[model samples]
Target: MYLTFITMIMTLVGTASSASFSAPNKDLMTCTIAVGWMGVALGALSFVALLQLRVYGYINTFIWNRKPTGVYFIAPIIYIISMSILYAILSFVLPLNGGFVYNNITNTCVAQNVIYYIGLTFMIIQTVVLCLLLFKARTIDSCFWEFRKMLLVASVGILFGIIVLAIQHVHFGDDKVAVKGILVIIFTLLPQQVYFYTILGPPVYHLLRHREYYLHEFAAIVEEKGLAHIYELAGGCPLGEISDLSDSGKPYRTTAVNRLSNDSNFSGNEPAPEIGAPLPRNSNPRQSGPLLSYYKSLWNRASRNN
Candidate 1:
């Protein structure tokens, strides 16, 4: 979300300046450099996201053994801040036309210096790293499969955008309309498409069309992998309930209890398991976080509906 917001701001500033101001305009030059710096920042953030995903996959498989430290989170913040500053400094300090290239056809100032390509090259390296990481994590289970798919598509988009920018600089310099259109596609449409197809589209389709099956699969995976504690990191489920389910090694199901209580054959004299009751004799100790309570609520709703 931060990346998205920053990207939009950079894009708006650059686009507005480009459209409204002419060459040698101070605001235009400033926006151009800002755009370059933000682009590098975006690449840095993208790499961080990939690293986080890999870490999450590791956590899922061996969370207790390889739990992340504060450094894991703090380090990325430091890297991004430092890199953004370094990129901005280089853009201004370099002697190549103040790091701004003039477009004769569009009468606009843009950044196409060696420093800009250095940032672009950094993005290329990040893409290569993404491919290597994806290859390494190819055998990971379904927990990360969707994210891997998203990264694959994102890698392709990044590469395509880089190629388009390179081509625009070298060959299509005179075609203003084509240049602007490609920029819009690269900066805006490509990301929207990748995110929709990889993240948004699949989940929504599953929820709308295969909700029961989706929930069942989620329950099965959570149960089998002892991943109830993972949701504790996401701040929805209660640690006590998660620990109960994890310790018992059972997916929480209220169906049987609901059925027994609702059955006409059941008499009030007999004891019935209460809905949402925590299991007994749970002894798992690492239970201090917000977590898997959403699934519990989900189960509660499912039970009441039935």
Candidate 2:
């Protein structure tokens, strides 16, 4: 999300620079040049994000124990920033497109082809690597479907962008408007689809349809802890700690119940029942199962006897 916001801001700055190109201000032109390189930097950062996702997928899919830490996480951002600064400096010192040129008709700064190709290479290589990683990562738990979908959309979008770039380079090279329009369309749709499929769509659906799922799951964990405490007081072994749901290598819905049944080390045919316990089972019939139904039956019998 932070990356998304920063990229959007850079894009807006680049757009504004082109929009106001008629002005004779050197400051704006300088801003244009800087933002152009920033665009390349942003692309590199985006690829870094993709690589991070691919690594996460590997960890989850293979259940790798030792994960990346400290320097592994921070180094990429630093590298991209340093590279962008280096590129900016070199643009001045070297004959990279002889520095940026402002095209009057397009109202945009034409950045160095060398820089453009470097950025394009970054996108292509990362996209291909991510797609290969996805074949394995797709087997990762479905709880991460949103992230997987986000990665998939990003890869597809980058692939499409490459195609667009090829077409623009071959046929529309002389037509600035055609090139700009094609780019605008690709960029616009790519972000919007990513936002919908990953960020907005799933959460909104959960809100509307399964509104109580999160609260219910949290309550179940609390109840499980309370039950464990009670069992400990009753001279029995305390229930094992609830595993972190995020770390669970199972489907979201069954994780808690499965953890309770398997990890609690209960030896009996029945669950540990506390006197005057709050109902922890979900009230929704569809979500209820044999264990929850038994709890409900116990509650009902207790209510009548009371």
> What is candidate 1's lDDT per residue for 226-260, written digit by digit as tens?
44334333222221111111212223222222323
Runs of candidate 2 with Cα error greater than 4 angstroms are 15-34, 43-62, 65-67, 74-93, 96-99, 144-148, 170-179, 182-196, 208-210, 213-306
* Clash statistics: count for each candidate: 5, 0
- Error of model 1, residue 19, in angstroms: 8.9
TM-score of each: 0.60, 0.57
**Per-residue error (Å), model 1, residue 198:** 1.1
- Which residue pairs does candidate 2 place in steric collision? none
Model 2, total clashes: 0
lDDT of 2 at 231: 19
lDDT of 2 at 53: 52
Best candidate (score: TM-score): 1
lDDT of each structure?
A: 0.46, 0.46
| Deviation in Å, model 2, residue 159 alpha carbon | 2.9
